[model samples]
Target chain A: MESQNIKKKSVRKAGLLSLIPGLGQMYNGQQLKGFAFLAVTIAFLIELVTIGIPAFQDFVTLGTVPIRDHSLFLLVKGTLQIIITFVFLMVLILNVSDARQVAKQYNTLGYVNRSARSMLKNIWENGFPYLLTIPAYFVMLFVIVFPVLVTLLMAFTNYDFYHIPPAKLIDWVGLQNFVNMFFLSAYRSTFVSVLGWTIIWTLLATTGQITLGILTAVITNQKFIIGKKFFRIIFLLPWAIPAFVTIMSFSNMFNDSIGAINQQVLGLLNYIPFVHVSDIPWKTDPFWTKTALIMIQTWLGFPYIFVMVTGVLQSIPDDLYEAANIDGANAIQKFTKITLPMILFATAPVFITQYTFNFNNFSIIYLFNSGGPGDVGGGAGSTDILISWIYKLTTGTSPQYALASAVTIVISIIVIGVSLLTFKKTHAFSNEEMM
Target chain B: MRGILSSTKFNRFFSRFLTYLFLIVLSIIIIYPLLITVQSAFNASDLTAFTLDLHMHWTLANFQQLFTQTLYLTWFKNTMIIAVSTMIIQVIIVTLAGYTYSRYRFKGRKNGLIFFLVIQMVPTMAALTAYFVLGLIINGLDQYWFLTMVYVGGGIPMNTWLMKGYFDTIPRDLDESARIDGAGHLRILWQINLPLAMPMIAVQALWAFMGPFGDYLLSAFLLRSPENMTVAVGLQQFIADPTNQRVAMFAAGSFLISIPIVILFFLLQRNFQSGLTAGGTKG
Candidate 1:
């Protein structure tokens, strides 16, 4: 009873001492670990008080003085400091937990606390995964989280054209940008129009490519077709070229006056007696620009879909089609009932990504026409999607950083919502079952 | 009339003809711009820049000019540095994380994965301004290593998912049996599991390597120096100005750079398909 009481006291004592960083480990007879942790914790605490608290203070105020204190700098510094504090707290919790675990083992299992050298030697096998993943997570804290946090915070601030840094200070403006973006007539209309086109572009381009890909795959898969390799190689040729290069090439070739599409492409198309060709305004008009974009996207993207669908088609049993034929199914019926469902089942997740991909497709729009044939309105071009518009806002001579960030948040919500739904519906997001 | 009454044979022939015709049309549509690009690359005609100058004086002069007169070679070197480094870093980190995620079930595993998923959905481009600001803070705007690390960081979430998914499909039995034989985790991974997972790793490596080549917006925004531009950014500069656009040189440079990549792309076509469906979006 006396020995049990002493053991119980030791466990509780270990837990209590952990509040001072490394004291618990020392109590548990882990001298090396205890000293290392104690030293590091003490050093961290010193810095936390000296730099961390002041950084948070500046983060809240942005800066008490203008010009002298760059708010952007203060904002960035404060964010980093906050991340550091969070990390420190996490480490502290882990250290406390470790101390308790060791103490419990001693009390319950009569475990011996191993020598520091032995423990250190065994650490690799014991903490292999954690050690390896630490660098990745550490980099992510700054690279992903820091930037994302800054952008999110910037949305609530006044960091636009008028509030150019160094000369004038930026301040937190709490939904002012959101209000102006949505409630204000000018910005609201632009948003609606751009968003409408964006939706249309995503739908039309993605669907067009998928449909074309499926159809081509169906045709190519027909055993009656000859030179299957040749046809497939030709079909997938465009995919070999990078998207930006292809888009840029199309941009030059679709030029209003001297572009090859107006002369060579159409002239060749008109070779068939049934087809007639005329000069289409690929650049000047909004309607044609949208049309051309969809076509170009279809042309650029179909190869990927074609490749995927073909792979799916090859694995699909010939007996399914043979069975359909025995059932007196016509071509359309066989396709609708068998081929379509099989392909969709196999390829739906990727297809959903295509929809989202086209939704935010920044490069194609920007590279194609510079989101071109500038809108009659003062801001965004007629062809500018939300992403390209955001690019325009943050870049160029006069940047609207705060407004762009607000738009970014809006885009984030929509994209994340779609992605979440997709992830939830498909097990693609999780490896729990497989693992 | 009697011979013509054999409609089935005629139907087969006619269907074959229609299929060929349709394929030919698509083939032509695919090939037209490529042909024009080729033509412009070789055409030494000052009379017409982007037109279908059918009577082309085929010259390798444009290719020569692309190397000598411009920063094409420099941009290629810069891009390769970023791409290769990003690829190496991503592979190391991704493989490590992937192996752990598949084998281990420690605290925050599920949360970590979910965080990766959610974070990737947060558009990399959405944080462009912040990244630019970060560069300013760290003074890494021109630093290739910085850019490479940023690429690795941005890619980790989705690439980890891809890697983990692929690795999970690798049986735990290999690991168990290896451990039974007294092999450590690293040795088991090196000897047994890694070889099996090579195809997936290769796919991941290729995707990671290809990223720096395709990106324009981020590279353009972050890189301020003239010599620091990646191929994506530098190539665009050629045709940025309409009056002074080096259309021929642009064509030549694009053509030159594309050959090897395109060949590599087709060669690994099968591998990439697996990677594509593994839920990665470079956008």
Candidate 2:
């Protein structure tokens, strides 16, 4: 108790000391934490100086060889090193601020400097959550954050096939890729058309899913329907099957020459009045391919909605319907008034997510027909959404990495903007307050 | 009165008839491709094309070929290693993250949440080049472990959100008492909240399993060796060759992969549905 009367440390002093990376924590009597921070920051700096600096130097020199030699490797290495340094700097700042806050608490509370053991105990108590989450953050930093940063920076560079690193150095050409995409005649037309189709596909596919799902759920929910569980499990099969497998299987079945639909089903339909069914060119012709993609997506997507809507439907209180019944509302009226709004209200965020998902539903398009019909030109096929187009641009015969990066940025902007807008309307963020 | 009753009865009958008719048609459309897949898997012909021939003989040769002629068993082994490892690690990381986000009030929490949401908007495929570069930097270019890390990292944001939402529902009072009784944060999370959040954890685990299992593009990009390929990538290779389009074998492979997944979904159907709707609406 007598030690509690000792003079408290100033937060500003502590902050200034922490500029040396843990000196402040030591001054504030947290030796172990201070030493740990000091050790980590010093190691980080050491690595940057030893490895990062040389890579960056190599990048600046554009390799020892002539510019004709590929130096994309050095550029990538340097860029990654720089990004890592930036993250470390952020961590350093956070550490300093945290030390300052703790020191300030000590000052205000008149908490006397505790022994090293007690300080460690303090960390164990208060820092446990951070400790638990650090591994996740570390993994995410490398896997998600780092890659995203690289992609963003890669957009500014010319890393296309022509500049394949090791033989040719990629130069930082800011906004040239964007200009090429939006202004250049050859690229712009393909960009516009692909974007248009992407939007159309998203809208049509989502609406189809929602319509089919709601209808299925409503019918299944009817008291007259028998074996409801059986119907549901059957419907769930499409979603239950791995989507890639299904898409590939569908691709095979839609094959023009020997496909089941063409050779068997359409062959049967050939006998129908006024129908002349032949090989439908399901994956080849542009028009038919797009149509097939939409249909398959709808099939793949609707089961999820059906499952989600069924859950929502179950939660809808029966009293509302009873009240509506008292008002003499018919089945259609009840559906439109009570069921629809409630489901929409509960599922608005998911609806937006569904749209965004379909917008970037790359695997289905890539696997189903490889975004084919190949006639759209400029490495984009008729069914190529922004995602698949980006994929093709990077992996195509003449890889346009810069253009792909630009497209990625564009797609990110669209998705984030739209999601934010819809999220606001749905009050998803507001729910965080309740927690 | 008699006439009116009869009319109402007729209307009810008609509506029920229409419902059945609609359901039956939708079921056919949905189930037809799967039926064809089954048929193709059994069809003995080397040609993978769908035939209308009713007399086509069923045989086990396609499955036999999948096991012997291709590296199907090796692919399964690789896929299981990746998926299982990813699922276990992901469950741990996501559980901790979700609990942190749910139970703690700290500086930068809101910013962290926003960061997750915004970051998730960027498609993982958008970073293909970066992934390759990352693979090189870590010296894990062709390793299944690297792919597992990617899958785990990719799943974190959504699973974290889901777990957080679930944790929010658990009564804080339960943990409050534990805290008063000298339990630390980790203890409370482990002893009090974990059991309650098992459903969400299970849901996250299932999804993590499926992520690596269903992925084609990433596996194709990361793993170049035929023996290292996952089922999805390996099967695609079977049909990808123009000259050797082993469609029947591919069908057999696809059928084989889907069996366990479909069975798992069935086992976890109720939990999966609740988990999805709960995350979508409440989280």
Candidate of highest lDDT: 2
Over 4 Å off in model 1, which ranges? A1-17, A268-276, A317-330, A376-378, A426-435, B1-15, B47-53, B274-283
Per-model i-RMS: 3.4, 1.8
User: What residue pairs clash in candidate 1, if any at all?
Assistant: none
Per-candidate clashes come to 0, 4
Cα lDDT tens digits, model 2, A1-435, are: 754687777889888888998898888887777888899899988997899888878767657564445465676677778877888898789878978987887877766345778767777877776877788788888889878877887788777887777666677788888898899999999999999999999999889988898889888888778888888888999988999888988888898887888887888898899989668888778889888888898899898899889989999999999999999999989989999999988777778878988998888989988888774667998888988888888777898877888889899899999899889878866756632
Candidate that would win on DockQ: 2
Worst 10 residues of 2 chain A by lDDT: A61-70
lDDT of 1 by residue, B1-283 (tens): 7677778689778888988888888998888778778778888875234666767799999989888998999999998899999999999898888777777887777788778778877777768889988998888888897788789998898788778767766778878988998998789879987898787788788778878887888888888788998888998988888888888888888887788777877677767655554433211
Please identify model 2 stretches exceeding 4 Å from their true place: A1-5, A31-70, A270-279, B51-54
Q: Name the 10 consecutive residues with the lowest summed lDDT in model 1 chain B.
A: B274-283
Chain B superposition TM-score per model: 0.89, 0.94
State the C-alpha lDDT per candidate. 0.82, 0.84
The TM-score, computed over Cα atoms with residue i paired to residue i, of candidate 2 is 0.94
Best by TM-score: 2
